[model samples]
Target: MKLALRKIRLVVHLLYGMWVVATRFARVTAQQRLELNRAWSLRFLQLAGMRLVVHNDGARIDEGALVVSNHISWIDIYVINAWRPTRFVSKAEVRKWPVVGWLAEQLGTVFLQREKRSDAKRIMHELSEHLVAGHVICVFPEGTTTDGRELLPFHANLFQAAVSASRPVQPVCIYYEDAHGNQSTAPSYIDEMSLGESLDTLLRGTPLTAHVYVCDALAPGAERRALAADAQVAIEGALDRLRPVGARVRQAAARGQAEQDAEVPHAGDTPAANGPLAQ
Candidate 1:
């Protein structure tokens, strides 16, 4: 909607969060901040009717780790943010979407104009700088959202950020479980749904349970792409194991399979919804 008006609310939230971050709960180190962030994320998910299933093998995801997850909906920001404060590397157009752009600014998210072919280089360069600086970054390697059933094929380019900065990239998967405890099969798309349409469609219905699974982190190196692929597989596998087999999940799998056949969003279909998400 109104971009100007949306920014105002973000400013308020930013100030409030900043106060809490800087004063009430002062942390000694970045790692400590991460711990606090995770606790907060857990609480956020609880309020959102979501649960986090983390399979952390004592793998400490300190300052130099990049979290890459499957894109599903705008809620991913809130889901991850509940766990930790992170910088998002997103499409440049997101900087104009009302309150979302303002929050991205406050959260130190970097936005690149994906509409231009050259923006990729700029994004990589920025990511390299941030990763080297020991900043925590979260990216959606799928580059787009899907029905919450299966992980889309990994976008290899986003994995390069961790390699460029010698940081580990972790894979995380998120899904929705309805009241009956059945997992949601699919979700809204930015290009396919606007903020109003999305909220209307989502809120009008009964709330669904959200699930976030954090898998073991991967090492960043020449095999970054391979790691990304493995992470996607791991998330999908974990999701499958957590929930029972359902027809929606099967259909979602088929949709992903068909996309691979046609090749989807090579680099420039990213749309701006309201924030650190797809259109």
Candidate 2:
């Protein structure tokens, strides 16, 4: 059974990856891209031996909005892609990663430098502009891969810019668990693994699962700091739903209020929420 599943997974990976590239050539509009994502992603999940629990409320994700989610395994990219027509905002260095990085660029991901404050400002400015023009940009607040179990404090800087953009902000939760429902402990990218080692690990006898919870979207005009804190709270809330055994509702409430009172000093009476509200 294990060998057969691994073989099936490899074939599906190739086919879906090809489909992603092929769709780009079709000059499909963003909506089309999103629709195709749902189909292809569901297929990938089935073949990869993953069961997906996507909690969405028909949230109307606005164009040019910023959606922040937690990062777990590299598969998070493909998994998220299945659900939306959003561009990923990742570290600039990811451009150098081998196969996956290549795909990210093809999908129009935005790259930002972490330590280069000035460059980061420029990237954020560009991101803001994109959102203004009506684009959905997705970012990982934790800034790195994790075991998909704990919440990482977010950097408020980027959230600040999203505030000025006046678009709805989304918080998404993600978790990857093994065959028996054990949260994956081997998927983090903290230590580099050779190509063969990684593939072998993925093909191991157990299949994993990915659960994504799309929480309420925040409206515009939140003060930068407040938005940052609120965003963290929203994401943590989504994660807690998946592991009710250790849910921390108070922690989420506190995180939600972190930067709220700060006020949107730079924001004028904002326009109506554009894409998806608290999507």
User: lDDT (CA) for every model shown?
Assistant: 0.68, 0.72
Candidate maximizing TM-score:
2
Candidate 2: stretches off by over 4 Å = 1-26, 60-62, 192-199, 244-279
lDDT of 1 by residue, 174-253 (tens): 76767677776433455668865664454433356666677777876656668777878877776766675675577679
**Model 2 TM-score (2 dp):** 0.76
Distance from true location, Cα of 32 in model 1, Å:
9.2
lDDT of 2 by residue, 1-279 (tens): 666667656666765666677667468776776676667667766666676767874774757678888876666776787766578888887789755677677777888877887887787788888888888888887777766667778877778658768888888888776776556655455457654565556556247777778878888888777877898888777776676442356556666777554443335644336523323
Worst lDDT window (10 residues) for model 2? 270-279
Question: TM-score for each prediction?
Answer: 0.71, 0.76
